[model samples]
Target: MEEKLKKIQQDFLNKTKDTKTLAQLDELFIALFGKNGQLDELSKQFKDVPKDELKKVGPLFNQIKQQLEISINEKRGTIRKQIYQSLQNEKFEIPSERTGRKEKKGHLHPVTQFEEDIVKLFEKLGFVQTDAPQIDTDYNNFEVLNIPENHPARDLWDTFYIDTTNYKLQTNKLLLRTHTSNAQIRILKNNKPPIRVMTLGRCFRYENADARHEHTFEQFEIVYVDKDVSMTHLQYLSEYFFKSILGKGIQARLRPKYYPFVEPGVGVDASCAFCKGKGCKVCAGTGWLELAGAGMIHPGVLTRGGIDPDQYSGIAWGVGIERMTMLKYGIEDLRSLKSGDLKFLGRF
Candidate 1:
């Protein structure tokens, strides 16, 4: 057994010197030290050997393994350095043959470009950018927004409910917020009025995804509350936003719409950019596209936020960022905004 172990050690030490690459070293390791390998089989044979020879065999086997490991690691380091050097010395070579002109660089993603443009426009209007947690309590997302638990607006169950094992209630009540408007409520509660805030973020819903609808989407909310604010202020801001986003040729119209948090809500519509309000496939031949939902703050919402409705008024508007992005860029599908495909995104 001692003679066999000596022969094995000599063979390994002599053979490994020829290993020029890490892969060759790896093969040697597996052949000798790996499971079901030569070294493992030798160790297993110890049970059949005389008891007095067991101690010597175990230590010899360990010494061989340790030496092999040291050599393998050292060779691996050298091989890695050589490979890195080769890579560093490599160069890109252009073809010698003539080629056609490459295509022009693609445009920005419509959503990202439009989002920046709108945020810049609103910044100029003195609306500071604000954000809220995507995961929110029912109070901040609902009750504080004047959509109490049992309100008809709660029927808007399209929201994503989060596991609330951590909450005191220990119920499935926390959620992925459904709209950026929830930020308005948060702003009101944390900051005293004379607040003009805008939020941009993702909102999740349980709705079916389509060309015009996405289960996850983006919306921007503009909330302004101060002394004696009115519908005229809301209209002016709405018109300015539409004109800024869609260009001077476009016009915006406000039509009555209802929302739980806003009294006498209005749907802000912009004249279709495509066909310029005459009629087109972009606007579904309506000559108008619903752009945003906006209205004056309801008294209940004001009271809930510690603001006196009689003493202060606020305007809140929720704009579908995807919708606006699609309109400005003539994008037909809302899903395009969410899809990360470079082919679709690069056309912005």
Candidate 2:
């Protein structure tokens, strides 16, 4: 039994010294120290040995196990050091230092470009550009706009409300403005009539995004307030702006619709340029693409804005900037605008 133990020790030492990698070291450990391995079989044989000899065999087995563990750890460290040194000796070219290729110049985002173009077009029509807060009071966002608490039109906007119990306007709710139309009442409250204001900004809604919709999106609204403002002016403005942005020969029509803030609202639709109003998938086979909502400002809304609706009538229209971008660029998915995909955006 003593001679057999000496043979096992010598064989383990010989195999471990020849191990060149961690994999081989692991295999050696399993063969000698694992369950049902050589060491386990040898330990079992101790039961058959005389009790006086058992003490001598037990100490020798422990000594071999400890030495094997120390040797494996030292070998693993040496292998790691050698591998790291080999990697350090390898040559690699730094990307920024490479020559002969022109650096790509960055450009404005497609949405910003669209906004600028739209602003320019509206400016030419005597509309003054303005902006509004993304976070606004519930009064300006809903109440001031004639959207009462129980009104069904309130359901149209999936609002993101903020806790205002600690705020100065504790009695009022705070929320992400659902539309740029909120700017209309705000502008009217601050400025008197004969206002030709065009506002473009981001709006939010608690909505699931799809090809045509997004929770966060850009909206553009133009509000014109003056005596004798009528549906005729609304139609003319919509057609002119649509033609200016969508290019020549485009036709726009207004179909009767309803909005709480806008009395006798009309749905604005433009003939699909893709199929020339003959009907196609781009227009969902309707031949006319629904564009925006426009109407004379409601008396209740005007009264909330401190304007005399009986003497002064106003026209206002709100359009989705992303929707316009989709039509202008022929993009199928609204998600592409907010995707952060350089390849998709670079096309514009």
Candidate 3:
């Protein structure tokens, strides 16, 4: 088995060397890894190996599979680069005019690019990206985060709920998440203290579409927990994010606000880059544009998350991705980010 594995590995590597186009590479990939393919057939023969040789066979086969996967990925990158470069000098028929010059295939969407930059920024501060269900239980989305039934904060979100009649569950038991804050309770409940995690994804709230708001949007939130956590840490994170993304000249400030999951919540603002902190119409003469909301986690939320409220504290900071991207790129309408206009997307 070991000898056959080594032989197949060598043969496949040689076969891959002969491929050029992505389509060819993809076909080669399936020939070796697909159902009833070389690797798959070999895997089905594991039982035929003697018990004494089985351990050796498993490890060798796994190592060779990993090596092959890595080689194919490297080749895939090379071929993609070649295609992109070659297309630069090639021309194709355009859909409208019936003829046009060659164009680069595509790019990461502006929102995706911006999200990646923010993820990198937070990773430097020991925060790793994590996820929660976009369709989550009301318990996790609201109750666990301390916004219980009839709470004034519940009115803040115009939620879209899932009907449970067919599922035999209670009404409003499951729904599209309104914000990324649903990740906080899961992170806290599942991980030990000194946790630093961020989540970025689609969040929905029923709204009348306009320049300033949308029914569906992206949200980015970070949940931090540990000893000595306080407002100062939250402030530092806000300032660090705005400065790193908006430029070092911009400044951040906090105004007292209210949130059920947090104590002494504050509305976060950054000095208007357009006015350089001087009053302007863009900032509504305030010289500060409201950006995010953050605060030290409330003891009730900490207790609910199974953390000892007396021993540890936390911070929850969240911002709208569209809003941040708009601010950074000087985009006027929130709807434009999702308009799917080639002229707008091509600009990036």
Candidate 4:
């Protein structure tokens, strides 16, 4: 056994000097030092030899195998580095040439961009962000917001109703919330006077799809209730919001309109940003685009929300996110805004 071990070590050393390449060295290593190789078979022979001699030979055999594996791994790493460097320097052109692949970077959807811009603008004006469940009850969605079953404003939102039987506290309904305005009732119930809140989320309507309308759309709404909050406050905020979003040169006008939730309701319009208020195709030659629906909070609406209308005058507005993004970015079709097309979205 002693003579065989000496001979194996001598043979390994002799082979190492003549090894001209890394591959030849690897082949030699497997034959001499690998699991099925001579060094492994010699170590196993210790079990048949005397126990006293086995202990001394076992460690020495393992040490030799470890040293050889370490040396071979180091050479393999050096060889790999050399091959990589050669490939980097050598350029063979023509056949099957590699072309640069274009990478598509993802971005926020345009509706999201519109929502974010509006949130930032309102946040600057002291409105705290708030949210409500997408599925809401009739109380918060309509009744508490001053839209009774018989009221015309309920018509303003084509509601998607849900099963009322599955609920314990329910009598007859649930709905896919039609507007962020529902957050107002929720906000007031959870908060007290001097409440200022804004919310942006999905809203549903049962309208036909067209260049300008969608059955499903995004809505942003703001509610401010405090002592002495009035239409003037509403007007100033509206003007500032449009100017801040559309730029410094924009102008807006308000005309009388009606909603069940707001008395002295107004339809707000902005001078066409694309045409500078001179009649143009974007504005449909109307010189103004309907921008928002806003009004002073009605007495009944305030009373229902656990607030006194006499003591607290308030104003609220709902802006269509689809219209805002489309108008701001010159998007011609409302459908394109939601189309999931890379060509359309990549621009923003």
Give each model's clash number: 0, 0, 0, 0
lDDT of 3 by residue, 1-348 (tens): 888999999998987888898999999899999999899999999988898899889989999999998989899999999989999989875574455655568898989999999999999999989999999988888998788799754564588888777776555488889889888888888889999999999999988987668999999999999999998899889988998998887788899998888998999988876677787665778877788989999998889889998999999999988878877887767789999997898887
lDDT per residue, candidate 1, 213-245, as tens digits?
888888898889999899999999987888777
| All models, RMSD in angstroms | 6.6, 7.5, 19.1, 8.7
Residue-level error in angstroms, candidate 2, position 324: 0.6
Number of backbone clashes in candidate 4? 0
Per-model TM-score, in order, reads 0.73, 0.68, 0.68, 0.68
Best by lDDT: 3
User: What's the CA error at residue 153 for candidate 2, in Å?
Assistant: 4.3
Clash-forming residue pairs, model 3 = none
Best of the candidates, TM-score: 1
Preferred candidate (lDDT higher): 2 or 3? 3
Per-residue lDDT tens digits for candidate 2, residues 1-348, read 777777888888888788888898888889988999898898888889998887887788788778877877788788888889989999987565477665667888878999999899888878898889999877778887777898754564588888777768655567888989879877888878898899999999888987678999999999999999998899888878898888877788889998878888999988876788898766778888887988999998888888998899998898888878887888877899888998788888
| 264: Cα error in model 4, Å | 1.7
Q: List the residue pairs that clash in candidate 2.
A: none
Q: Name model 3 segments beyond 4 Å from true.
A: 1-99, 153-157, 170-172, 274-287
Off by over 4 Å in 1: 1-108, 148-152, 163-172, 278-284
Scanning candidate 1 in windows of ten residues, the lowest lDDT window is 94-103
lDDT of 4 at 177: 84
For model 4, residues 1-348, the per-residue Cα lDDT tens digits are 666776887787667656657889889888887887988788778779787877777777777767767766776776778788989999976433345555556889888888888988888878899888888877778887667788754663576777667668635777888888888877776778898899888888778888778888888888899999989988998888888888777778899998767878999898876777778766788888897999998888888788998899888898888888877887878899888888978898
Alpha-carbon lDDT, every model: 0.82, 0.84, 0.87, 0.81
Badly placed stretches (over 4 Å) of model 2 are: 1-100, 165-169, 275-282
